[model samples]
Target: MDSPTNSQKTVSDDEEIDYSIKPELYDSDLDDKDEQWMAKKRDGRTSDAVLSCPACFTTVCYECQRHEQYVTQYRAVFVVNCEVDKDRVFQPNAIPSKVGKRTRDSEKQETGSADNERLNPVFCATCSTEIGVVDIEEIYHFFNVIPSEP
Candidate 1:
């Protein structure tokens, strides 16, 4: 019997493309000390601190230098209150819904994801500077700001 020609050979149905490369592991050691420090500074302020530029819908935390300077030089600081309320200081159109949704989903999939609350950084209305952020579960409270010395 003669061997099969190139065009006469039978092809197997179980052949599959191989894609067995192992995924690369991510290193989580990037320096986040600055962010941690900033968050800590913002969380250390008292609630009685006078809110500046209250009409502007943005949060102001004590961790920001501009807020600190305003408090130091003028004895009072002004910040845009970005909390969601009747006045709505933050622009609804400016919020990125898709990004926020994706982040929320990712957090849900990770371990130790019990904390469902989210916080977004607030921006100054006039200069567009980041003054602080609002914690969703914290009763619309602002965290982090440069406070004037008492």
Candidate 2:
């Protein structure tokens, strides 16, 4: 998807894309698996394919299935180039965040409280379909995603 604003360029379906780096790569912080994927991209042996919401064809992100889960638990990137509406939330992960070493008691003490930590749900702006989750506690971005496939 092309940015509605002209400063950003849209990629054609047939085009061969090579981004210096995808934002998600940094977001994940690069595990060994992620590093391998990066090496492949650098060598021009592989590239990411566009992953979009099937319901509305809204481009959600560009990713390689291999490099996925490098940063987040699932192989989805929330801070993707695609457009979404934050207001139209539907579902949330029933599971709680299992951040390391912090017990329920510790979480309450460390950050003042665990209540402040939040995971944002991503929805399709056009169809309101839930696509992914964002960790809003640290900042205004997603820590994980469920990349939609057509």
Candidate 3:
């Protein structure tokens, strides 16, 4: 086997190297496993697509999928109780309501203690438009939302 020579050296002592990187290597924090995870998080309607707010065309979230626990489907729209991996949500783009108690009006009829964290309304950070809801399971359900290519 040929050994790497000084001329073939790609990184310097001051530089960092992580061979486990995949495509979009600029995101050093993620690896092949993360890519695979993101790939698996696609929905039937919008496969590996970017989700945006229909009102203001603001970018809301991306690579979201239908809720695994309860699969829902809406007419004309692809997302039915859409959700993205917790790590994929861009905190600045997707705004969620403050932690509070779950209301009786929630989709699920189950009630919990006051201290229990409740589902939250998610909005577009830029437009403050109602985009979806984040359930107690921490899944984002996009309603009347638009999907765009990444």
Candidate 4:
């Protein structure tokens, strides 16, 4: 049998696909972490290594931190160990959603220390997604930063 001649033009011969509307779809600068994050996102999942808001993909904390655990069901209970960590993880406008006063007794019962402090729920400033709760010690307890199993 005789072979057929090639008719189709290759991508290199044609104009590049217009990804201007969604440039991120064709972003060539995506690093390994970003690629992993994108893959996880496509699979309807998330990663603890990159603490970003699942709704808006706003990074709350980056990797390479020595914090206790960025990924956990305890709502990042020990993630922000101190003010420095808090400053690193949360932005300045990342304030509490609401304030609720907790008695020292109840606080002690829950955290094993008696210190009167107001507990507040932290929400994403961009999407207003309920990220987590700030406990008496100013530690974040994320409820659904990413829809991941812990």
Candidate 5:
């Protein structure tokens, strides 16, 4: 009888060989079909809401996604449901007459024009879509009042 070489492994009738090393060799079509099925499964939903700039009418959500420095002046107010507390919310402080005057004067002094006003987000005047949140201090401030947990 000839002795087996190191490259040749002896297999008995009861031995099981693992063919999983070349998984792609077995199911190329099945893998492609699975990818197609996943792509189809992922295409059924639309966004319930969208954010746009009040002045420019451009989609500002992408800009808001990036972290930016913002000054939270008392004039610019926003209403937001607290994610953690649930019950309490922050509403924009009413623009005080004195504060408004100061802001206007400051703008006039710095820019030589009184057009540097912070646009307050209200209901989209054109689309009538409710402004659900305002981005301030790089945080999303939700307007929906959250119910308190018992």
Candidate 6:
């Protein structure tokens, strides 16, 4: 009859009902990008966070500039592009995932719901910055940055 409150439950409200001990479920201030977000340093702290392509220095992901290595996980892990949800800013590669069925199946199971999906390299449209790897559907982006680079 009306815009149901927490009383009249639905699929969308599974989060509100599940009382699991998932810390993320409780903390409302977590960003999904913290895992793969790194910062370009200037004065010990990440003062220059313009995460451009290391090969060409072309700006690809402008959002990376806003991410800080001090606060976030800063591990540079692979994440579902859906988790990033900043598709407009990212640039998916023209090529497609060339791996075999085994890898594809594994990737799908890892991320889930990416049926018939494949991954591709997300290089800098302008420079040599390989931001990460993403699926053809832009569903998953694998980006694991080491501590230092050439």
Ranked candidates (TM-score, high to low)? 4, 3, 2, 6, 1, 5
Model 3: number of clashes?
0
Best first by lDDT, ranked:
3, 4, 2, 1, 6, 5
Give the alpha carbon lDDT tens digit for every residue of 1-150 in model 5. Answer: 888886787777546655556755577689789757644643542222333534435332311121234222111122221112223233456644554444666755874432232223434334444443333332443232111111
Question: Which residues of candidate 4, in runs, are more than 4 Å off?
Answer: 1-48, 63-118, 147-150
TM-score, candidate 5, is 0.20
In the order shown, the candidates' Cα RMSDs to the true structure are 21.5, 17.8, 16.0, 13.1, 16.4, 20.1
Highest lDDT scorer? 3
- Candidate 6's displacement at residue 128, Å, is 5.7
Q: Note the residue pairs that clash in candidate 2.
A: 28-71, 134-142
**TM-score on alpha carbons, each prediction:** 0.26, 0.35, 0.36, 0.38, 0.20, 0.28
lDDT of 1 by residue, 44-105 (tens): 65333434433443334342332353433222232433333323343224534564444565
Q: For candidate 2, which ten residues in a row score worst on lDDT?
A: 136-145
Residue 52 of model 1: what lDDT?
45
Q: How good is model 6 by TM-score?
A: 0.28
C-alpha lDDT of all candidate models, in order: 0.43, 0.50, 0.54, 0.51, 0.37, 0.41
TM-score of 1: 0.26
The alpha-carbon lDDT assigned to residue 43 of candidate 5 equals: 53
Across residues 1-150, which tens digit of lDDT does each residue of candidate 4 receive? 666556643456236655456755566666777768656644653335546676877755432222365434433433321222233233225545336864566755774532344456676776777666576676665645544221
User: For model 3, which pairs clash?
Assistant: none
Task: Estimate, for each residue in 50-143, the C-alpha lDDT of model 6 and write its tens digit.
Answer: 3344565443332332235453212232221213323434444554756664556676677566334544555555543455655446433425
